[model samples]
Target: MPNKLEQLKKMTVVVADTGDIEAIKKYQPQDCTTNPSLILKAAGLPGYQNLLGEAKGWIKSGESADDVIDKLTVSIGTELTKIVPGYVSTEVDARLSFDKDAALARARHLIKLYEANGVGRERILIKLASTWEGIQAAEELKKDDIRSNMTLIFGLEQAIACAQAGAYLISPFVGRITDWYKKSTGTKDYPVDEDPGIQSVREIYRHFKAHGYETIIMGASFRSAAQVEALAGCDRLTVSPQLLGELEADEGNLKRQLTPTMGSDKEDKVSEAEYRWSLAEDAMAGEKLNEGIRSFHQDTQKLKDLLTGDQAQEKRAVAQTGA
Candidate 1:
C-alpha cells in the first residue's frame, strides 16, 4: 500500500503550504502556497539569505520598503516555480485587502515582477483576501487573463462570491475553522466526520460541484493528519510540512470522502449586499476572517522590519569603513 500522501495525490492535488523550499522538494506537491507568515518564517532560514540580500539591494536602489518586500516575495515565488509544475500563489498586501484599486494595482505589480523574473502570469495565482473589495479586484483581474486564489475564505458566501467572480481557486482554511468552533463550544474532541472545519469544506465542495462552478476548492490550514485524511478527495489540500511528513509515513488506506454530485438547487448570484449580510451573520466566519487578515498584516510588518534593520546595519558598516 502506498503511503497516505501518495494515495491522496491520486484523487487530489497536494499543495505544500509553506515557504520552506526544502520541505516542498521533499513532499513534492503539485502546487505550493505561501502567505506573509510563511514567508517571514522562511526569511529567517540561513539558505534564504541570498534572497533577502537581493531584496535589500532593491532598497539601496531607492525602492520603498513595501516594494522591496514585494520583490522578495516574487523572488521566492520565482524559485518555487522552478520546482512546482503548477501554479504558485503569491499574495498581495494584506493591508490592501479592503481596497479594490490598491489590491488590483499591487497584484498587477506582482505579476509584472514575476514576468520580469521569467515566470509568466500563467504560472502564478495572485492571492487575495476574500473580502468584497478583494473579490471585485479579482473579477477585474480575470478579464486581463490573470488568475486569482481567494484566501481567508470562511463561509459559503465568500466561496460563492469567489466562484461568481471567476476566481481560479479558493482556499478554505480547515484548521482555523476548527479552532474557532473548539474555542466557542468548549469542546476538545470532534469526531472526524463531525469536525466543523471538515464539514464546512464538504459543504462548500458539494455546493460548488453541484452548481458546476469552475472555481477550484482547495482545503488549507490543516491541524492534524486526521483532518487531511478526512478530506482525502478534495480538489486540493495545501498542507504544512509537519502534516505532510505524517501523511508520507502512514501507509494507511485513504478513502474518498468527497465526490462530485449534481443537484437541481440552482441559486441566484450573491450580490455585494447579500454577501456582506451573510458574512456578518456568521459569527465564526466574520471573526476568523478579521483575525486572519490582522495576523497576515502583522507578519508582513515584521518582514519589513527585518529588511529595514538589515539595511540599517549595512549603512552603519559602510560609514565605519569610510567607503
Candidate 2:
C-alpha cells in the first residue's frame, strides 16, 4: 500500500511549513510557507549563510532598512518558488499586524521585489495576521489583485473576517489550539475527533462549504499526524517537516474525517462589534492570537538585528580584543 501522505495529497493541497530547503526537497509539498521564526532558524544553518550574508551586504544601501528587510524576505520566498510549483507565502512583518496601511505597503513592496526578480505577483501569497485591521488591509490589496494568506488565526471570528475580506487563504492552527486546550483543561490526551484544533478547523471547513465562501481554509501548526489525519479533507494543510515525515512513514488506512457536508453547517454573519467581542470572549483564541503576534514580532526584530551594522567585522573585532 502507498503511504498515507500520498493519499492525503489526493484529498487536499499539502504545504510545507518550514524554510528548510533539504526537507522541502524531500517531501516536495505543493506550497511553502515561512514566518520570521522559520527564517531565523534558517539563517543559522550552513547553506543558508550566503543568503544571510547577502542580506547583510545590502544594508546601508540607498533603500531604507525596512526596504532591505522586505527584499530579504522576498529573496527567500523567490528561492522557495524555484522549488515549489505553487505559490510561496511571504509574511508581512508581524509588528504591522494591527496596522492596516503599514501592512499593505509592506505587502506591496514584497510583491514588487518578487516581480523585479522575474517572479510574478501570481506566484506569491503575502501572509498577514488575521486581525481586523490586517483583514481590512487584505481586502484593499485584493482589489489590486495581490492575494494574501491570513494566518495566526484562532477563532471563527477571524476566519469570517478573512473570508469577508476575500483572503486567498486562512490557516487556522490545529496543534496550537490543541495545546491551549491541553494546558487549560490539564488533559494530555484527546481523541482525534475531540482535539480542539482539529474540531475548530473542521467546523471552519464545514462552515465554508455550507456558506459558499471562497476563501480557502488551510489547517496549520499541527503537533501530530493524528491532527493532520483528522483534517484530511480541508482545503489545505501546512505540515511541519517532522509531521510530514511521520505521515510519509505511516501506511495505515487514513480515513477522511472532515468534509463539506459535515457539521452544523451554519453560515454565520458577524458584525465588527460581534467579531471583536466574540474573539475577546474566547479565552483560548484571544491569548493565542496575542502570543502568536508577539512571538513573530520578537523573531522579526531578531532577523532585522542580524543584518544591522557590520555584523562580521564587529564580531571579529570583539574576538580579537577578547572583550
Best by TM-score: 1
What's the TM-score of every candidate structure? Answer: 0.94, 0.93
List the lowest-lDDT window of 10 residues for candidate 2: 314-323
lDDT, residue 176, candidate 2: 85
lDDT of 2 by residue, 1-323 (tens): 87999989999899999888899999999999998888777666676778878887888555565677787778788888999999899999988998999999989988888999999999989899888889999999999999999998898888988898799999998888999999999998999888888878877887788788899999999988888998898889999999999999999888877777764646488778877897799999989998999988877666666667557744543333211
What C-alpha lDDT, on a 0 to 100 scale, does residue 321 get in candidate 1? 28
Model 1, C-alpha of 4: deviation from truth (Å): 0.5
Model 1: runs farther than 4 Å from truth? 262-268, 310-323
Q: How many steric clashes between backbone atoms does each model show? A: 0, 0
